[model samples]
Target: MRQMAVIAPVAMVMVGGLSGCDAAQPTDSRFAPDYQGVETTLLDGDLVKFDVAMQGARGPVDVENYAECAAAQYALIRGYGFARHLRTNVYEEAGLWRGDAVYTISPALPRGVRTIDAEVVTASCVENGIPMV
Candidate 1:
């Protein structure tokens, strides 16, 4: 009885979490304009470049936002709270949108152009429907 009460909630939470998981690679076309994945490269100094691509009928703005989300998540993984956007090149080819974004990570907001709070950016990404990796 007591064991069932404890296990029931745990099981329910686990099932809910799994069924509601939104991070998986989506195969259905219903989620069009979907985020595919991200490629990251550590550059000289504290800069990291993220190349993000997506499939479907998305636009350049979507791809750029997805890349920025990747950068924000990466900054958080690296124990940083801010990312300074250096540059980004967005393009579309063969029905795919790809963006190459460069960012510098720092604990404090970088005194440069387009500095982003990683936590804020990540939250905004979730709200804007941009997938992060």
Candidate 2:
């Protein structure tokens, strides 16, 4: 009876594990991101605004990342070596996500904790398949 009890529990666990493996797994399309586009606006001399949109984003962080990628590329295009994040506003409606972000481009590192090296950030964005201006 002792051996039978142990074997039954072990068999039940094994069957449970195998059944779990047969359960439906999440598809790639569920998490795949779709980058819509980006719009750039020069707010002031070194201050710039990035309006970015995307679909199938996981959350606001994805939208913010899109804005960051745009800022990085814009800084590089303007011959700036660094950028400082000023502010960002993220919104989602239905399945579309939008980010309105502002950043400051400078030839040298800006005085802020949210600063980014344009060259480095741009390279990372490209590697991660993120779109930039």
Candidate 3:
């Protein structure tokens, strides 16, 4: 009787554990997107540029600057998952950071990942070349 009681609890625990693990598995294609690529165009003829717009916690990027420009570059390249044979020059203007990055995105990305999350790094807080505040 004592051995039976111990085995019953152990068996129940094992069953519960198995059930939990099964629920943790990923779902089918309903949640996945069929990825292809994104569209690219020229801002200036042969200046070698592509324009990408992504939402940030603050607002649209000011690509005319430098640091935020770099961060934006990192975000787009990683977020869109573009191929090689591409490079870039990032810039900002009117408080919007832009990446004139050199890459050939398709007409549109099939994966359907809309937003690229990028941390805003800026030089505006510089005092003697050190970031303040």
Highest lDDT among the candidates is held by which one?
2
Expressed as tens digits, the lDDT of each residue in 14-83 for candidate 3 is 9999877845657553412111122354434322244443222132222222223333343344443221
lDDT per prediction?
A: 0.86, 0.94, 0.36
Off by over 4 Å in 3: 22-47, 52-99, 102-133
Candidate 1 structure quality by residue, lDDT tens digits, 24-121: 67675565576778999999767999998888744667777888899899999999999998899998888878889989998998897799999999
Q: Report the candidate with higher lDDT, 1 versus 2.
A: 2
Top candidate on TM-score is: 2
Q: Which 10 consecutive positions of candidate 1 have the poorest summed lDDT?
A: 26-35
Q: What order do candidates take by TM-score, descending?
A: 2, 1, 3
lDDT digits (tens) for residues 4-26 of candidate 2: 99999999999999987866867
lDDT at 77 for candidate 2? 95
What is candidate 2's CA lDDT for residue 35? 97
Among all windows of 10 consecutive residues in model 3, the one with the lowest summed lDDT is 124-133
Q: How many pairs collide in each candidate, listed in order? A: 0, 0, 21
Cα misplacement distance, residue 88 of candidate 1 (Å): 0.6
